[model samples]
Target: MKLHIVPARTGFQWVKLGAKTFFRQPLAMGGLFFMFMAAVSVLSLIPLLGTLISLALVPAATLGLMAASREAEQGRFPMPTLLVTAFRSGPANTRSILVLGAMYAAALMLVFGVGALLAPDVPAIEMPEGEVSPERVRAMFNNPGLWVALVLYVPVLMAFWHAPALVHWYGVSPFKSLFFSLMACWANKGAMLLYSLGWMAVIMMAGVVMNLLAVLLGGAALLNIVLYPMVLLLAAMFHTSIWFTVRDSFVTQEDRAA
Candidate 1:
């Protein structure tokens, strides 16, 4: 597939487009997002491997959301089953996303593995096995493991950023999709930089607004209680923005289909 070379300013437009798309189908999109999060949360509850499985499913879930966005664009409500479009499309599509998921899981595992290796003696909570205490959490932040994991996750993020869309939309293979996604990001790094900065600006503005509300209401607890929906809204928009970025990176739907 031929990648589109959009201007650096295009990133902002993608956010705008994402917002428009999300608003057009807010109920459907919101429900789908809730379902997605619920699924992830449930999967992450497993004893040891749950988190990895949840991470692996992320790409597939993301592709499903992209499909939902397309449906919303067509003025149709996205169905709950849209979450599994990647898996149900056909063997080829299923294989591509599954492989991508495996790679993502492996990469994340590698990141944590390296982190453990780097800080084998990192202390744990001195409590029940399944219960995490505040001291343990604080200690983890002061340890090397967190930083190592964060540093190692960058390449993994880059590799999987646009991979799901590439596979679902353009029928790209798993490994090639990773390469193309990386190249596409590198090529459009300037736009993405702007995009990231824009997100930070929005987040800052949200914080400002939250603080203002807290002060005006004379109770930070009140705003804290009410701000959850707003945060979820911003999160939905961010996920939608990811779809827009992927859409703009490739040829038009008709051309890509051909």
Candidate 2:
């Protein structure tokens, strides 16, 4: 595959195309996403190593979702088996993807460790007598360590973003896949930025609409009832968009020859 530069407007196109494609087979697409989450959750139940294993499976999982998206884009119903596309590609591709996953997991853990060191310890806030305060919940997320971890995560994210596809489709080595992924991201930073912002806007609008619904429908109970399903839909749509990003960012040999 050859790298291709996309205009910033292509980012918005990705979002729209993703949503449109997802709607075309909402049940199948949404089911695949849910299945992926279920698989991850089940893996997370394993033991002390469960979390690490789940993290390591992330790149593969992402690739599987993108594969599903590819199917949906082509007007085919993506089967549940598509979820394992990465592992089924071939022994070499599977090995490369696993190596990429391990690298991602390690990089993330190291970043988290450094972030923890950089952030000051947060004292626990004890609430009175069986009370659940929003302030306390918000405080947990207001940690500097979390922000630091998030900031450090960007490059790790970049490195793995397209690495799985590169490995599966091109037989690229693990290290080279990471390099190409990073360079592609840097090269297409404008499109990537707009793509990210578009998703952010979509999510923010969802939240606003959800809040309005809660107000009209009468409470947090209704909000909670709607929130989980909405989250799954949004997540599915986001994964659907990822395939477009990869598609636009790279060209096949035939396209190059043309």
Q: After superposing candidate 1 on the true structure, give the runs of residues whose Cα lies further than 4 Å from its correct spot.
A: 119-144, 252-258
The TM-scores of all predictions, comma-separated, are: 0.85, 0.93
Q: How many backbone collisions does model 2 have?
A: 0
Per-prediction count of colliding residue pairs?
Answer: 0, 0
Q: Show pairs that collide, candidate 2.
A: none
- TM-score computed on alpha carbons, candidate 2: 0.93
Residue 186 deviation, candidate 1, in Å?
0.4
Please, what are the lDDT tens digits per residue for candidate 2 over residues 1-258? 889998988889999999999999999989998987898788888885887888888888889989999999999999989988988977888888899899988997899898888776667778886567897778767778878889889998898899988888778899999999999999999999999999999999999999999999978889989999999999999999999999889999898888
User: What lDDT tens digits, residue by residue, belong to model 1 across residues 1-258?
Assistant: 687888999878877787899999898888888888888889878976888889889999888888888888788988989989898978989988988998998898889888888775754456976466888877878778779899888767877989999888788889999999988888888788788888878888998988898888866677768687788888877776787888778786587686
lDDT of 1 at 251: 81
